[model samples]
Target: MKILLMLRDEFYQANPGLIEDAKKLGDVRILYTDQGIAKDELIKEVKDVDVILVAVVKIDQEVIDAAPKLKYILKHGAGYDNIDVEYAASKGIPVTNAPGVNAQSAADHAFGLMLAAARNIPQKDKEIKSGHWELSMGTEVYKKTLGIIGFGAIAKAVAKRATGFDMETLVYTNHRDLAEAEKLNVTFVDKEEIFKSSDYLVIATSLTAENRYLVNQETLSLMKPTAYIVNVSRGQLINEMDLMGALEEKWIKGAALDVFEVEPPINHLPGMREVVATPHIGGATFESIKRIGDLSIANIVKLMNGEELEHVVNGVHSRVTQR
Candidate 1:
């Protein structure tokens, strides 16, 4: 089997073991490119490859159509939105992701954002840097209500951390995991209630068509004026324009975001004081990268050996039979 690794240069450097393990399994090829490997280039790259591992690169129908020998696709992280899942399914190419690999790291980052926003950490730091002292009063987390938008692994981790701070946790998910919620002592509440009552609202859901603009203007209007919001999930989950409006009108006190609708150009949005933005570094920690790399390699090796994968996003047996 021939395996192609499509990742950034930094990731390649940090996870050298992935390349070595792939080499042991088959003829391994690594392409460190941020130009995103155009459809034609992807076709040429995967012409003779049996598997392709992708990060943020787009893997649409054109690329899938070009690779006849492609057996499986491994996404570096949990989100598979970059891949054409339906097309990959039709082509009988099973796709898998390293789910729960970076759950702790992402949850930690989400909490970091929450703390920063709640306590006005960034604003105070900025004031001190400018030679101002004892300028701002920040809110406390204890006795505050934390509303978690999604009840996934990351959300569970966040809830666990929040409980230690003596904050009440509320969760809202379409397909509620009652057992897990109860186990975490997370109060399962309606979305509107969460929006209205939360002192700190954290978004930890995956991006789907149904939730592209889950936190829109209408939803933002429902939030408390003193509340803070944190988003560590997909950027598009919150409408940027709507968020900007909220911040400008002081509908919400502040927001800390790790992801954005248009990354790198996130600064173009107004309301710098009200919004704390990071360049999508929720899962960029060394520990998380290593875990994701190792898990991705394991999934790839399993697929090559015709064994069951650990986290197959598409139906596992269906792909095998179709292929």
Candidate 2:
């Protein structure tokens, strides 16, 4: 087996142990890219690779079609949107992601954003650093309502942490998972209720065709003028222009985002004081990276051994036959 690691050079540089470890499975090759490589280079590098371990790079249909020996595409983290899963499925290549591996890190970052926005932490830090001794009023999390847009593993983890601050949680998901919600002592509500009731609203959902721009102008209109919003999930969940309008109009008091519709967000995204933005680092913690790496490696080992793969996201099943 020949494994192609389609990851950042920094990642390859940092994890020499992982490279040595991959030798246990196959002859591993490292191909670095800043999210994506040129089509020609990608085609050249991917040819005859048995497995591709992808890190944030976009593996489109063109690249997928060029790889004749490719049997598997393993995602380093929970999101597989960067891969062309439908096309891969058509070609009988199984695609899998390391789900729940970074849930704790992601949840922690979401709460960090919530507190940062609510307390004006970033601005105050700047003021104090500039030799100005000033006090800024920050909102107290105690007894406040926290609305979670999705009640998945990460959202559940956030709700669990919110308990330390004595928050009341309301959740809005496609379908209510009543048992889990009850376990967390959270209430399930409609989308509008989530907007109306939360003192701090955290967008924790995945990006899907149906939910793209889920928090648009109309949804923003429903939020409290004093409320704060935090997004730790995919950036396209909130419409950027509508968020800009909402901030300009004070539809919501403030926002802290770990992801953006466009990375290294240009234009008004970087210029707004009402917004606190991160370069999509919600799952970038050291612990999360290690966990993701371990899970991804385990999947690769399973694939090479002709065993059932775990965390298969695109409905591809076990290749191992039971006769």
Candidate 3:
């Protein structure tokens, strides 16, 4: 079996033992990319691979079509939105992702962003470094309303942390899972109600065709002027232009984003003082990366040994078997 790793060097740096572990299942090869070049280079490398472990990289139909020997495509992180899972499934290739492997790390980062944005932590730190000793007026989250967009593993993790802060948790999901909501001690509400009531509106939902730009100008209009927004999920979940307009118009107080519609956030927008943006480090922690790597490699080993596959995002797991 031939395994291809198309991920960052940092992933290997964090989990140095994975290389040895992967060698037990198959001959492992790596394709490290820093320039985001996938189509041409990835096509050249994946020709004879049995499995490909990818992270934040686009494996489109073009790349999938190029891999003749590919049996499995394992995402290094929870989100498989970057990969063309459906296309791979059509080609009888199983796609798996390590979901809940980094849920706690992402959840912690979501709340961290909320606190940072609310208190202007970044701005104040910058000012303090510039010889100013003033403090920014930060809002309190204790006993406040916390609204979550999705009720996934990471969202549930956030709900648990919110409980620690004595927050009133409200959730808005496409499907109302009353039992699950009750277990989390959360109230199920509509989107309108979530925006209207939350002191801090956090977007933990997955990126889907239906919910893209779910938080737009119209929805922003419904939010309390003093409320804040935090998104540890996909950037496209909120419209960039609408978010900018809302901040400029004071529709909402501020935003803390781990992901952006366009990474590196091309153009400048108003209200930088109110926005705390990170380079999508929600699942970049050392512990999270190690767990994700372990799960990904385990799935590859299962496929190579004709064992039951875990975390199969596509329905093609049955097609992948031992050589």
User: How accurate locally is residue 251 in candidate 3, as Cα lDDT from 0 to 100?
Assistant: 89
| Model 3, global lDDT | 0.86
Worst 10 residues of 2 by lDDT: 314-323
Model 1 residue pairs with clashes:
none
lDDT of 1 by residue, 274-314 (tens): 87777677887788889988887777666755678887787
Ranked candidates, highest TM-score first: 3, 2, 1
TM-score of each: 0.91, 0.93, 0.95
lDDT of 2 by residue, 206-228 (tens): 78889999999999999999898
Q: By TM-score, how accurate is candidate 1?
A: 0.91
lDDT of each: 0.84, 0.85, 0.86
Kindly report which residue pairs in candidate 2 clash with one another.
none
lDDT of 3 by residue, 107-180 (tens): 99999999887788899899999999985578899999999999999999999899889999999998777777
